[model samples]
Target chain A: MTSSFTRLLVMVQKELLELVRSLKLLWVPLVFVLLGVMQPASMYYMPLILEKAGNITEGAVIEIPQPLGSEVLAQTLQQFGTLGLLVLVLVGMSSVSGERNSGAASLILVKPIAVFSFTASKWTALLLLAWGSLSAGYLASWYYTGLLFGDVQASKVLGSLLVFGLWLSFAMTLTLFFSTLLRSSAAAAFSTLGTAAALSLLAGLLPKKLGWLPGSLSSFAYQTAVSDIANVSLFGWALACTFTLMAAALTGASWLLRRSSAID
Target chain B: MYDNFDFGQILPIIAPILTIQLVLVIIALVMCIKAEQTRGPKWMWVLIILFVNLIGPITFFIFGRRNER
Candidate 1:
C-alpha cells in the first residue's frame, strides 16, 4: 500500500494553483506590500516634506509626533495593520465564494474528490498566502524601521506581529464561514466586515472582565503587543477563542456541504 | 548579524523560492493530466491544473480523475 496520501497532496496543489493564477492573487499581495512599503516610506519622509512646504499657514508652530523610536513602529503598524487586514478580508472573501462562482466546486464534486478536501484546500491556501504576505511585509517593515530608528527590538516586533497574525486568523475564519454560508462573493465580503465590526462593538458593550471573547481579544492584542498591556490569561483566552472560532467555522462549512450533498 | 539584509542579496533567495513554485506547478499539471487519463479535451483539466495548482491537482486526482457522476 502507498504510504503517502497522494490524494491529499494533489488537492493541496490544486488550491495553490487557483490562488496563484487569479489576477486578484497578484493584486492582493501587491496591495499588501504597498501597505507595508507605503507606511514606513511615507512616514519616514513625511517630516522632510512638511518642512519643505515652508509653513504656508504659519499661524501656529504645531508639533507633530515624529516617528522615532517606538513612534515609527506605532505609525507603521497602524497603517500596515489596517491595510493588511483589508487584504486578509478580501482574500477570505475570495477563498470559497470565488470557487463557488467559478463552478469549480460543482465540477470537482462530480469527480472522486471528497468534500473534506475542498474545505481543507481552501483553508491551507489562504493560510499559506497569509504566511507569505505577512512574512514579506514584516521583513520589509523591519528594514524600513531600522533605517529610521537605530534598530527596533526584534522581540517586540515579533510579538506584535504574532498577535496580529492570530487576530487575522479570526477575521479570516469569520469571512470563510460567511462565504460558506452565502455563496455570493459580495455577500461574503460585506457580511464578514459587518459581522466583525458588529461583534467588536457588541464585545465592548459587555464587561471588560470578559476580555477573552473573540471580539475583545482581537482588540486587546494591539495594546498588549505594542503598548505593554498585560494579562497572560487574556492571551490564553485569545488562543482558546481563536481555536474555537476556527473549529466552529470549519465545522459549519463541513456541515453545510454535508447537508447540501444530502439534499442533492 | 541580524540586520544583514542587502536588498540585492535577498532577491536571489526570493527568486529561487518563487521559481520552485513554478516547477511544482508543472509537476502538478502532469500528475493531474495523467490521472485524468482520458483523451478528450483537457481544457477543464488544464484550468484545474493551471489555475488551482495546489488544491486543483489533488481535487482533479480525487474528484476529476474518474468519469463525472
Candidate 2:
C-alpha cells in the first residue's frame, strides 16, 4: 500500500514536470489572468470604447450602468466557465491518450505501479493544474474587481470560488476519462465539451428537478456571489453530486486504462 | 467625450494585461523558432503567433508543437 502511494506521488511529479516542460504551467494561468482582467477592465471602459467606435452618430450619448463588484466578479466566473473551461479541457485532452499513442503507456505499464496509481496520479496533476489556474485567475479578478468596483465580502467570494472550482474539476475529470477511453485527443475534447453542454442544458431547462446536478454549479456560484445564501441544502446536494460524478469518472478512467492499456 | 477622458489614466489600469500578452507572445515566438518539428510550416506559426493577439500563442502552444515530450 505504501509503495503504491509512493508510485502515485512519483507519477504526479512526472505529470507536473511535463506541464512545466510543455509551458502549460506558465501560459494557462496567464491566459486565465488575462481573461479575468479583461472582464472588469472592459466593463469599466465600455462607455469609452463605445464612444471611440466609428458607428456612433454625432451628439448621441451611450449610457452604460456600472456593474456592482459582485456582479462583475460573477461575470468573471462566467468567462471562466466558457473560455477558461475550454482552455483547461484542451490542455488536458491528451493526458492518457498522448502517452498511449507514443507507446509510452506500455513502457510505463511494465513497471510495478498499479493502473489505479497511474490514473489517480494523472487526475491529481490535472486537478492541481486546474485548481491552481482557477485560484490565480479568480484572485486576480477579485483584486481587480475590488479595485475598480466596490469590494465584495470575502466569505462570498471564497464560497463561490470553491463551487466554481468543483465545476472545472468535473470538466477536467471528464477530459481525463475520455482521453483514457479514446485514442484521438480531439475526440476526447469534443465529447467532454458536448457532455458538459448537454448536462448544463438539461439542468437549466429542469432546474426544479435537476438542480442538484453539477451543471447547476455555476449558477449556484453566481447565486453565492450576487445574493445572500438562501438554499444551502440545494448547494450541498449539488456539491455532493459533483463529487460523486468526479469519483465515478476517475474510476471509469482507471478501469478503461486497466482493460486496454495499449489501444493504439 | 475626448475633452474629459484621459488616455494616460487607462494605461496603468491595462498595463498588466499588456505585459502578460507581451510575455506570452515572446515566449511562443521563441518556442516556435526553437522547435525542431512543428505541425505545420514554422514560418506560418511564427506569423500566427505574432499576429493573433491572445489566441495566437495559445493556438501555437496547443496545436503547433508536434514533438512533445
Best by TM-score: 2
User: Tens digit of lDDT per residue, candidate 1, span A26-128?
Assistant: 5445445545555666665465456556565755454667555455555555655465766577657756656666666667767776676777777777777
Estimated TM-score for each candidate: 0.70, 0.97
Write one digit per residue (lDDT tens) for candidate 2, span A1-264: 887788888998998898888788899999999999999999988888888865899988777778999999999999999999999999999888989998889899989879998999889889988998999999999999999998999998998899889899999999999999999999999999999998888878998888888998888889888886567787789889999999999999999998899565
lDDT of 1 at A253: 84
Clashing pairs in 2: none
Model 1 accuracy (lDDT, Cα) = 0.63
Worst 10-residue stretch by lDDT in candidate 2 chain A?
Answer: A227-236
RMSD of each: 10.1, 1.3
Superposed model 2: Cα runs more than 4 Å off: none
